[model samples]
Target: MKAKVYVTLKKGVLDPQGKAVANALETMGYKEVKGLRIGKFIEIELDGASQKDGEKRVKEMCEKLLANTVVEDYRIEIV
Candidate 1:
């Protein structure tokens, strides 16, 4: 089994990196860009766990380390 975790800044948090990228795009003639946000993607391999258990473990990982839970939100997908 495999799990994919997505981590991203929560709304209302300052995203300097995302802002910088938007500014660069504007300077480079990609003026159509209105806004941008950046995030992280992680993939983990699980050892033959049931779907329910995999999800539970992944959620724990997210809460413990994968996401800040304060300034960031995470979504998980098991496959």
Candidate 2:
């Protein structure tokens, strides 16, 4: 099975990297972008009996190591 995890900074967390990118874009003439936030997407392959199992394992992975629950939120998808 294949799993994808998306990890993102929680609302109200300061993302200096994102801010810097946004500022650079604005300077390059992309003023339409009012805000920006950076996030991570991780893909993993596993031998799961079913999609449900894959999702369960991926969620656990995110909660345990892939993402910091105190500062980040995550979503898991199995394919």
Strongest candidate by lDDT: 1
Clashing pairs in 2: none
Q: Which stretches of candidate 2 lie over 4 Å from their true place?
A: none
- Could you give the C-alpha RMSD of every candidate to the true structure, in order shown? 0.8, 0.8
Task: Estimate TM-scores for all models.
Answer: 0.94, 0.95
User: How does residue 53 of candidate 1 score in lDDT?
Assistant: 88
Write the residue-wise lDDT of candidate 1 on 34-78 in tens digits: 989899999999997899988999999999999999999999999
Q: Model 1 off-target regions past 4 Å?
A: none
